[model samples]
Target: MSNLSATSTAQNSSTPIVLTIAGSDSGGGAGIQADIKAISATGGYACSVITVITAQNTLGVSAIFPIPLEHIEKQLDAVFSDLNVVAVKVGMLADCDIIKLVAAKIRQYRPAFLVVDPVMIATSGDLLLKAYSISTLKSELLPLADLITPNLPEAAELISSDVPTNKEGMEKMIGKLRKLKFNALLLKGGHLIDDENSNDLLILPNHVEQLNAIRINTLNTHGTGCTLSSAIASYLAQGNDLLRAVQLGKDYISQAIAHADELDVGQGHGPVNHFFVGHANVR
Candidate 1:
C-alpha cells in the first residue's frame, strides 16, 4: 500500500481512524452505537456523523427525527478536515436529502475504503429509511460504495425481485446486483430460514468467496449487520484486502453472537457483545 493508504492504518499510529455515518440508536444496540463498538473492538478508532436519532429500544423504533443537512455537513467537515480517515461505513440515511448529502461529502473525501450497509428495515419490523428515498439511495449512494452489504430482503428490494431462498438463487441475485458497479458485494444469508449455517456470499469482479458459520441461536441479534459491516471497515483500515477483511469480520461477528447472552441490556432482542474480550483480558 502507498503511504497515502497507510495514513489511516491504526496499527501504524496509536489507532487507525474509521468513520461511520448512520443514525443514533438510543437503545445502544444498533446504528452508530453498534458501529462504534464493533470498530473499536476490531482495532480501529471510530468517529461518527449521525444522520438521525430514533426513539427506540429492543422492542421497536417509535419515532425518528433526521439531523439537519447543514449539521450533518458540518460533522463531516470537522472529521475529514483533521482525521486521516482510512475507511467509512454508511447506514440508515433516513431521507432523500440526507442520502444525497452523505453521498456528496463521501465522494469529495474519497476515503480508501467504504462499506455501505443497505439498512432498510429494523430487526423489529420497523422501517428505518424513508420509502421515497430508496431510489436516491440506489442511484446516488450505492455506486460509490467499495462494498455494499445487503441482506436477503434488502437485495430483493434493491432489484425489485423476490427474496432468494437458496444458494443458487442468491448467486443469481448477486449477478443482478453486480451490474450496479460496486467494487464488491456481500450478500448476507443469515436471514435464510432453513439454513443450519449462516452462509454469506462475497462477490468480486473476478472471484466469489463463501463465508459460512454455524448459526448461533439467540434473540440478541439486533445489530448483527451493523457490527459485521463496521468490523469489515475496521479490518480494511488495518490494511487487509477486501476478502481478508470480510473473513475476519465474519469471525468477529460470530464470536460476538456466541457471547451476546452475557450482556443483559434489553428486554426484547439485545445486542451482541462487541467487546467479547476486554482489553485487560487480552494476552
Candidate 2:
C-alpha cells in the first residue's frame, strides 16, 4: 500500500474522494464514464482506473479489449498512492485474472467503502464478463465488498437459478443473496419493470429494506446500474450509513431516468440525465 496522505489531491481535505475501477464506454453512457459522472453529480471527487475498453453505443457493444494486468495494477497503485479515496466502486472486470488482481489490491489498500457492481451482461444482451470469471467474482471479490449491487439477471447468475420477476420472488432472491456472506447487497430490481413499481432490495447483515419507485417508461435506460452503484459509493464516502446511502442513490437514479428524454443522444437505449438537477441541457 502506498502512502495516501503524501499524495492526496484534496483541495479541502474534507471533500470525499471516490474511485471507480471499471471499463471505459466509448459512448460515455456506462462503465467508468457513467461512474465518474455519477460520483461528480453526487458531490464526490471522481477518480478512475480503467479495466477494459469497449466499443459500444446505445445500440450495442461491438468489441471489448481488456487492459493488461500490469497496467491495471499500476492504475490501482497510482490512485491509492495519490488520492484520498474514501470509497471504491467497481464495475466490469473482464476476466478472473483481473478479478484476482483487484481483490488483492483492495485487501491491501482497505478503503472505507467498497461497492461492487456485478456487471455480467449489458442491457442490450451483450456479455461483459467472461463466463469462467463468475466463480472468482463470487468467492474472491465479493467478500471484500462493503456493498454489492446486482440486477435481476446478475442475482440469478450468482445463485445459479432463475431470478424471480415478481415482488415475492425478488424478496426470496434477496434472502438467497444474503447467504453468500457478503457484507451487504443492493439487489437492483430495475429489470423487473413489468409491474407498476420497480422496487430495489437492500440487504445488510442485520436487516432488509425495499426501495420502491414508480417505473419510468423510457428507452434510455443505459448505465443505470453503474450510476446507482457510483452514487451509493459517493454517499458512503460522504459518511452516510449504508441504508441511507442506498436511498439517496435510488433517488438520484429515479430523477436521472425521469429526465433522460431531455437529452437526445444515440438511437438505441440512451443514457440517463446524470446532471438533470442542475444542467438540464448541454447538447
TM-score of each: 0.93, 0.93
lDDT string, candidate 2, 1-283, tens digits: 1111222333335878999999999999999999999998888889999999999999999999999999999999999999888889999999999999999999998887789999999999998999889999999899888888999999998998797878788887866787796888888887776788878888877888889999998999999999999998887777676777788899899999999999999999999999986632210
Candidate 1 lDDT tens digits, 1-283: 1122443344565567899999999999999999999998888889999999999899999999999999999999999999988889999899999999988998898887889999998889898877788889999988888889998888888888998887778888867887776778899998886789999999888888899999998999989999999998888888777778898899999999999999998899999998887531111
> Global lDDT of each model?
0.87, 0.87
Candidate 2 weakest ten by summed lDDT:
1-10
Q: Model 2 lDDT vs. the true structure?
A: 0.87
Question: Which clashing pairs does model 2 show?
Answer: none
Backbone collision tally, model 2: 0
- After superposition, which runs of candidate 1 have C-alpha atoms over 4 Å from their true positions? 1-14, 278-283
